[model samples]
Target: MARASTHPRSCGLKHRGFGRRFALLLMPLLVVGCAWGSSSETRTGDRAVPDPDASENVTFYPTYGYLEDDEWVVPVRYWVWEDRGLVSRVVTRVASSMAGLEPQQVETFRHRLRPFSGDSEWRQRVTFVFEDDPLGQEYQVLDERGRAPRTDRNGVVEGKVRIPAQRAEELLAAQGSQGGWLRWEAVSRDHSGTGQAILVPSEGTSVISDIDDTIRITEIPAGWSVAVRNTFFDEFREAPGMPELYQEWDGEGDVLFHYVSGTPWQMYESLSEFLFHEETGYPEGTMHFRTVRKNLVSISTWRDLRSLVSAGAETADRKYEVIAGMMEDFPDRTFRLVGDTGEGDPEIYRSLARRFPGQVEEIVIRDITDDRTLRPERLEGMTVIPAETIERATGPDAIVADLRWQPQSVRVLW
Candidate 1:
């Protein structure tokens, strides 16, 4: 009886050890299953949550173009945001950057991540009303329907509207000695929001001015840190006497001021605000901006990373393309190219002057860098004046004297 009991006890101990081993092996799988379940639930809940701060505020970005026979076409684009709040936007931007998703993927994810943020097709009908004189009389809003915003590769929707133009010569003649601007306002029928556009005279000397380092302090040649700080964190600071120089150049408001920059179009709102608040006396003609890549991190950083890598060669090429297009668009009007030495502006301007012989009147290079390599060489017919000489030149009288076309009498502000 004692031997039989011992055998049964031994078998029971063996069975207990096997059960412990099995439980140890199954424990990891159970933990993994629980983790996966929790994650799935969290994702589902996130998909169900609605965006509370979505708004219908619209933004406009106007481009310059001239129509045939004294008619002008101001091509304007608008953008509608799902959420304008800073924190929500930051979160969205981070998610967008990390995912590196395509436009369609982004649209799909918008519902899963932020259901109330709306899709890329969310477009509102808007109407533009011209308030100022001469312009109101000359041009009318031919098409009242605002375009449905289409998403670009970067998931940015650009809605377009062209403000029609007619009888521009008559409008210009009416202004006479008193120079003024034609203003128009755009308002959405569905949303309580508005945007403005200013039209300048297309005739006379067209001044193509560079924005970074030339007009605003962007320290491009200094280094990346300074450039990034100035662009994102620091306040807008204009170059000394640049506003005065621009005012003098626009004597009698005949000169058309077109701001051309290598800065991406994303910074348009901030730059426009800076221009408006600074009171630069610069007549808003047409704003030309660079094409941006479809990357949220690069966009959020204001393209500072790319800027550091670029050696100004690519920027010069872009500037040339934009300027050359302008020259082709307005063949009759003479151009005055204004830029700084931080980039290849001097070299680029010189090449442009050579390419368009009689069309390019002058090349004004602001010597931000004391580099002697950019010394002005006679570029046949066109005058290349340094900014230092411009400051001492004593207003329009002295400045015009340096130009090829010296009028008998010039407007003197100083």
Candidate 2:
């Protein structure tokens, strides 16, 4: 494990307690222009555009949950498009800049926009039918009445579906020792969706990873300008060999991945797409995201950049809470906590180690900041690897060896 430097630099804006407090106090005033319709109009006329429907706009985000009693209580969510055309894009771009979106704030904006002053197809009820060979041999249609409220009024539907333990067990048996993901398909009246669910073995390693900075580059600790450039305008970049490293850890079977990040649920699609293209080899598991309230005010008009800088300050706490919950949920499973030095991952993981003890197998903190001083004292299972080291071909193997994780013989069935 990498050791923390004895002489660390000041921990940046996130470490300053006063900055966050002041931002909270000014939140109300700063968020006043968050409404979708409040932005200056760019169109020539007040003409209505055809709204997108389920067939063209619906998207499903893959997520997982622990098995409770006799079922796998998985969290399933899908987004229906109200509009994905130029008009909505223009509104979003203008609104985001006006709000001066912080990385976290940008996610909130992506996940929570509503029809401020437009013809809304937002909350139209839609029943989703789920089918999985392992869960059952038939399609199970979820009742519309039982579905939970949309995560966002701008067409995001949230709900949970359970797969029977018997079916899950059968699927595992079919995989024959090298447990693989159980595939599932979903469909609405006018759209279709798909995802995979992992039946975590009773005894194995589960890697809990942080997405931004840790794997995907967002330059979170960097101020609002860098955040905006990376998140909104720039292309998504992976942290060197992270994808291969994760794949190496995921070798064969006996390893599961759960991404717990401060990134809002709105970026689910974007992240999913990135993972798909990057071929990170991380299997779809449960993704825990920050709970961002809809900011009624615009993000662009803050009095100073300090307010925007502090927007995601609460993420450290949120990440801690989610990781703690994962520990409680899977008490028997060992974990490898992966994160970066940009935020409070080291402290958070240390606290988790103290709280859960032996359950944590290791802690791998990517040294994105490159300031070794920011690293904490060497703990029993913590290692800080510099980002530069990860860029090499040998980097992935070195990481695996350092973690002392034995690779299993994985069979690719698909």
Candidate 3:
């Protein structure tokens, strides 16, 4: 547990002299869609119980903190917003499995960052941004008990910060556990929005689709053929059975939906619309883009000198930058990445899985036109389901059965 003596004097004080500085240090850790609750010993949000019965309105409990000896700081807070409920399902699952275990046994959580249930609309979304902290190079979340949440998530509960089973039960009873997540539940998908819907599933299956040609046809080079592939599109279009597939799998239960694309911010508007369009829309998941700029110099400048950078310059490295940014924007939920064989989608997804293996449940790769030659050998030890499309992949029970196999790494890690 976190020792009260080590907590900064600004822990409970709002907007005091150190409040802005404290908030600045902690803000980077405050992302959307994380499960949370107060520990019986400590009233921190990280100990919240599960919400197995999630509705359209999901509440997220964000855990934020920095170390006592280290410069790392985080301002974790809860945000109730609209989410596609993609990683939300995954986190809920992992959270459920780890419910009774000690905090030391818990692993990392993941999710993409986008608009929470608020002013952001279908056409354009208000992205949650993060500012840099000079006090430290590493970021960490500290529980109220003053202990860091476990990262390895192995079944040996020890030095980590967690709520006891009895405490979790008490909190769940008080908060109405939905989807197995305690303080934070998912927002209902039925709420009026611009995003499309598949036939609502009795148990929602999160759609982790690619954003490029999977929806919008963006022009890009593909070997000897024209670089322009149908998946990396500019305008959102309905791919063959994608809409129906998303709807069929759509539901209010344990579904974690996401769209992990390789498109840079240059196509942010187009990509955003493609994910939330009316004709071929699905619920909005975290939209990953390229880095704001390449190289450490660009990164430093963007983090410290955002106002000076041009929009194009920011969009240049948006892909890589967005990956890191999402960690802070949505800390509660981990991701199940879905992308295409085109471009650098595989590479990016692989890197993410590698950096936070526990957070990524699986990688679903849609093979466009039998281009196995272009595919990677593996995706960071996780199962990579290579399919032609929605039907080809989920067509029969064969593919689904294959997907049921335990990932060698996750099984070992778990």
Candidate 4:
């Protein structure tokens, strides 16, 4: 078993002295989701759960850390933020709920960002920004014996304990206890947030999927209005049959999922609500967002949607870097890159395929735009397929089963 793990102080705390370096001694892992219990809703303003926010509000974007002295040095990345214009009309609402605004206020905010006047969808998405995650805020690490009150989650952390490398692996080996993870439970007299680290398994198939257009029905290339309509409005439509297809892949042997997108860290909870919802039910995986904007004053106008396509090579570069790092981190594990021509996913995969020829296995690019024409030369290693064709896939291995898809007929992402 690994020793008690410690999470170093979170970012944006450079100035303080006395309460300088707090470390969390994470308890043995718990499977994320459905451990909701308020120590009883201590009300303040609209919020219920005291000053503490649950996983529904506080999002964790955990990545595996390198092994140090035989134990895995796991870094748990978490954030706490006020809804700003986010959350619900009533504090009773959580996750995807955004603050209600009148017509004038919403339009005023949208007009500052886009020349176009706002619509209902525009207003909904426009106000979807987090009140900056407080800088210089202090977070204390929980003791080894700290246990958050649990409702129904079995392994929902009764006592905290350090994880040794061997112990973590053993947990992964257990039949029903399988899946790569190291969960952290937080217990504050005021707030509650429990996050888990996605451990990089020794040998497993990893799928690095894209969010926009590829999995979610986000017509980013369809213009700004379409993108906004899709981002915040509705519970989010799946890209045809991606949710079912992804679940199939999840059941295919030992598969781990990762979503790399231009979506900012602020939208983590909202996105999580869509992806992890039992209705949509995409595999539980680590999400990596592009920008981490502190304040939403400038962005409150819903301008960030333009980054979907207009972000240029900067978008491709960031995705390439993320995918490359993943392949490098787990050389033995093969990866299937699934993306759409909606974003520069094909080009990003092309770059990585060349760099890590051995690690990157199949490149699947989905095309749904009206103008379906991608240069075959640019997508040298990718297999362009229609959504219907992929939906026909039986399992992960069958993803490229019908590679009759031609790149020459794919949409070219800006």
- Which window of ten consecutive residues has the lowest lDDT sum in model 2? 396-405
Best by lDDT: 2
Quote each prediction's TM-score. Answer: 0.59, 0.66, 0.35, 0.58
Backbone clash total for model 2 is 17
lDDT, each prediction: 0.50, 0.55, 0.34, 0.48
Count of clashes, each model: 0, 17, 83, 9
| Ranked by TM-score, top first | 2, 1, 4, 3
In candidate 3, stretches whose alpha carbon ends up further than 4 angstroms from where it belongs are 1-209, 223-235, 256-266, 286-321, 324-334, 369-414
- The number of the candidate with the highest TM-score is 2
Candidate 1, run of 10 with poorest lDDT: 1-10
Tens-digit per-residue lDDT, 42-146, candidate 2: 333765333333253445555656778888766566555433333345555654545444455444444333322122235544444334333345433243565
> On residues 1-414, what C-alpha lDDT tens digit does candidate 4 reach at each position?
111112121211222221111100000000011122232234568665532442223334645543445665453444432232211221113111232323433332232211011001110100011112122222232234443222111111112223467755654454223355655444433234556656666677899999988887755554433344344333356776677778898889688888888665546666776788887788888887765221223342223333432445545656677777677767788899999765567767776777888888889878764224434554565676665321211221111111222223322221
Q: So what's the TM-score on candidate 1?
A: 0.59
Give the per-residue lDDT digits (tens) of candidate 1, residues 1-414.
001111111221122223223222222322222222111111244343334433455455655546655446555555443332222233345434543434543343333323112222233444555443444532222334643444342334433334336443444345441343434454444333344444444566789989987878766654443354345434456777777777788675568778888776657766776664536545555677765432333343234334323443445566677787778777778998988766667667777777788888888877755443334353333343344321211221111111122122322110
What TM-score number comes out for model 3? Answer: 0.35
TM-score-better candidate, 1 vs 3: 1
lDDT of 1: 0.50
The residue-level lDDT of candidate 3 at 200 comes to: 17
lDDT of 2: 0.55
